[model samples]
Target chain A: MPAQSSPPRTDSRPGGRSARVRAAVHQAVKELLTDEAGDALTIPVIAARAGVHATTVYRRWGSVGELLADVATSRFSGDVVVPDTGSLREDLERYAYDLAKDLSDPDTLALVRAIVGTGGEGAGVCRMERQRQLEAIIEREQGRGNQVPTIERAIEALLAPLYYRAVFTDQALSPEWARTLVSHLLPR
Target chain B: MPAQSSPPRTDSRPGGRSARVRAAVHQAVKELLTDEAGDALTIPVIAARAGVHATTVYRRWGSVGELLADVATSRFSGDVVVPDTGSLREDLERYAYDLAKDLSDPDTLALVRAIVGTGGEGAGVCRMERQRQLEAIIEREQGRGNQVPTIERAIEALLAPLYYRAVFTDQALSPEWARTLVSHLLPR
Candidate 1:
């Protein structure tokens, strides 16, 4: 048989070239943020680092604030792993503690602050990721015949305080605080 | 005797010319923010508007972000009035609803976002102001012989959700939502 060579195809699927571009751009932003002061960050610098055209970066991200929000939200989405500890209280406490720890990181906190500061669309994405994780935990609890609070209640009572402290206050987020919040949410 | 004329003294007291200068600078920032795009705001422009030296503005405020944070915090401090409705639930609900309404203003929200984005000292000032208001409400409830949740609990149950939704979610902050949060915090 003659040598069969596949032609170079333009992959425009959502998870194909588009996803790759986003990953590269996000990675470039992270590297740049780490290597340089935030004041030194700009679209052209990021585009150069990512090996993408500055116009493409600008068209996709709009501004440095929006781009930072996207990168931060994506980092949260990837880093968070919802626990399946089988007990709802334990699961929530673990999740909350992990979230508190993650948010305590300076870089992560900066990203979160950027997301809120930018008031961009990334906040919704971050909220949805947390909602999905909570829903999974709630579904598991339901299957186990345990009474659970509504997702809205869980969000208000459990998630809100953690983020509130992280963003607005100088209060420390401890494991005990996470446990207390979970206890209040899943009261006996 | 020759007419005794008082010497011109530099008013450096806390609420004297120093305070006047600060007020003028903050007012200039507010007017500039309202009149121009945030990108066009700079120390020199703000100082020029305030009729102060650019070096003075720079030395005091450090950057536009800090200046915006100061303006926003001072605005909140001056604007917020803690309710005394003779009932804890009513007071909390009214306060929260008002807060939601105030935060809904585009300019106020932008100022808040800037404060968080800047990660400056203004967050501490804002938190302290809210804490003082909460303490007043708590003391009033205590004087009435009503069993009230602790200030920490009130913050977690009542205040956090409003800000959480305002900053992070697309959820509407309705009077009913505020009432619900109050009810949760102070159950009958």
Candidate 2:
């Protein structure tokens, strides 16, 4: 991991006392969302949790939806790393296995679930961000001159079963499951 | 689609007005959760919508978490159809392409986003029902007696790209996307 003097700020807006307060509020909100699970989260409650004034929350974000989206962006940070392992099959298998592990993690799962559930303005934003991540990964792999669509399809095919199992089915996330998905799904 | 029928009753106890009310309440609750996005729902609002007393909602579901899970089971009516296409690749590709189409529909996407956004309770129920569907498809393919995990993996591989694109990325659900995913992912 790159040594960070502070958490990387992707937003280009000026960083000041307000930015610091917003960051703190977002961290508090994320923690509460993870811990409380379905409990009604109010602005006052978040303000108390973050040790900030209620006005700070209102002035910076205006609504819980905006705050949640900011938190979602921070929590589900990083791009999908695309790998080049010579063959499309190897590359896809690795991508699937890695993504399965990431999606299965409780923290990532919660944030993803929240984004999926809260499908208002935030949901659309999260969906678009996720798309950007995929496009970035595709560009990286395509730079290597592997057939873009084929490689992209191969990677998606390999990862989809584990996700289907993890998110929509009851299958255990076993090495066998990953390997089977790869072996059967990957072009020989 | 199966012949339409009245919603099922939830009471077996004799001489029960409360039971009838409860049954009506749950049925209405189920529709609200499944038929719409999460943003449009609230317990008080649901009670008004169902024409049930608000106290009943608290007594039966206790929390949104429990209510959400119940809604998922009630909404999921049945499984996917897996046609025997004479070859594993054909069968897998057919299933993949069809499932992709099913998933891409607006109602299904809304349900998926809602179920995923909530928590593990709804997620678990949703996954179990889906597994039953997928397993039925797999078992039929296996019953042809040429079945292997590799075949299953390949089928999953074939379908994963469409879903990954739909769920994790913002790609348009084009016929070309479907063909690209299936052609590269499906085993010969």
Candidate 3:
């Protein structure tokens, strides 16, 4: 007799069967979001795209809004460390440029569009996540004995402009522009 | 009689009866949005709240989504002007702080929520309007001549931080923080 076969699975984690299924569903959602525009967002489409049962999608996220939020949040997060160069301006300039680069990337931009489609309802929470990231960076700088005031301000200086350019201006945040911003602000 | 008398209307606009009616409807829609959350957004509810004929709202905007977009767009605009302080850093710092204050204000926050609730369908256009305002400020600064790369960077440094703080951090753009940001980015 053939040896008992192990369950077919795709997830690399040790969370077992449900985790594997969830991982597949999550990946499918991310792909759909990346490929489609805001208007194309829907559950059946996502389920079909992921090759999962529609009920699985519903069970995982509870709603399409939540699912989109999860995809965007996951895609945009994780330990994005802030680099320090002693001078606050230089440090901040690098920080800002890197952030602009990250947000302007194709996958990230798609995630932004998805979250933005939901408008300000989810914006507050989203903003909170960003704030946490900023706070961590600032605190790290402070731990190095940097002046809190200068470093905090530098953090703002670096990031707000790129976002203003993206969300308010509808302009892509270019590396040249980032370099220009950093150069003037840091001047080192 | 010296002249035929017209009835005093709740709408203050000068026009024929239809125009007055339209104004009333618009006002009503605004009030409803201000008071209710996203889930409460609906045509019949809006019509009843506005006290204008429901058909007029539909006729003017075509659908609930369209009407909501129009209302959100019409209520907020990208028209903020940055004051010139003869120092780029100072001006930008003021601009950043003021923008945060404005965007986070109760009225503006509500408007943002309304816009976001629309699922970012109109976000691109709205962002464009905001960009025009920022560009206008930048253009005015450039008009002063003697434009330096550092000053330009200062502009982004000063402004971007506040927005990043507001939209990303979910924290109120504090005046103290603005001052610190300006000091660090601007040359002494």
Interface RMSD of each: 2.5, 3.5, 4.7
For residues A119-157, write the lDDT of model 2, one tens digit per residue: 445655544544454455566667778656544544464
Candidate 1: clashing pairs of residues: none
lDDT of 2: 0.62
Q: Tens digits of per-residue lDDT for model 3 on A114-138?
A: 4554443344444445556666666
lDDT of 1: 0.78
**Tens digits of per-residue lDDT for model 1 on B13-76?**
5568878889999888667655534343567888999999999998887777678767866787
Question: Among these predicted structures, which one has the highest DockQ?
Answer: 1
Per-residue lDDT over B50-91 for candidate 2, one digit per residue giving the tens place of the 0 to 100 score: 798788788888766677677666655555555576665565
Candidate maximizing TM-score:
1
Superposed Cα deviation of residue B124, candidate 2 (Å)? 3.3
Instruction: Please give the lDDT score at residue A136 for candidate 1.
Output: 89
- Relative to the true structure, candidate 2 reaches a TM of 0.69
In model 3, the runs with Cα more than 4 Å from the true position are A1-17, A20-37, A40-66, A77-98, A116-151, B1-69, B77-98, B113-155, B179-188
lDDT of every model, 2 decimals = 0.78, 0.62, 0.60
> TM-scores for chain B, in order?
0.77, 0.65, 0.67
> Candidate 1: where are CA atoms >4 Å away?
A1-28, A31-56, B1-56
Better of 1 and 2 by TM-score: 1
The DockQ-derived docking category for candidate 1 is: medium
- Clash number for model 2? 2
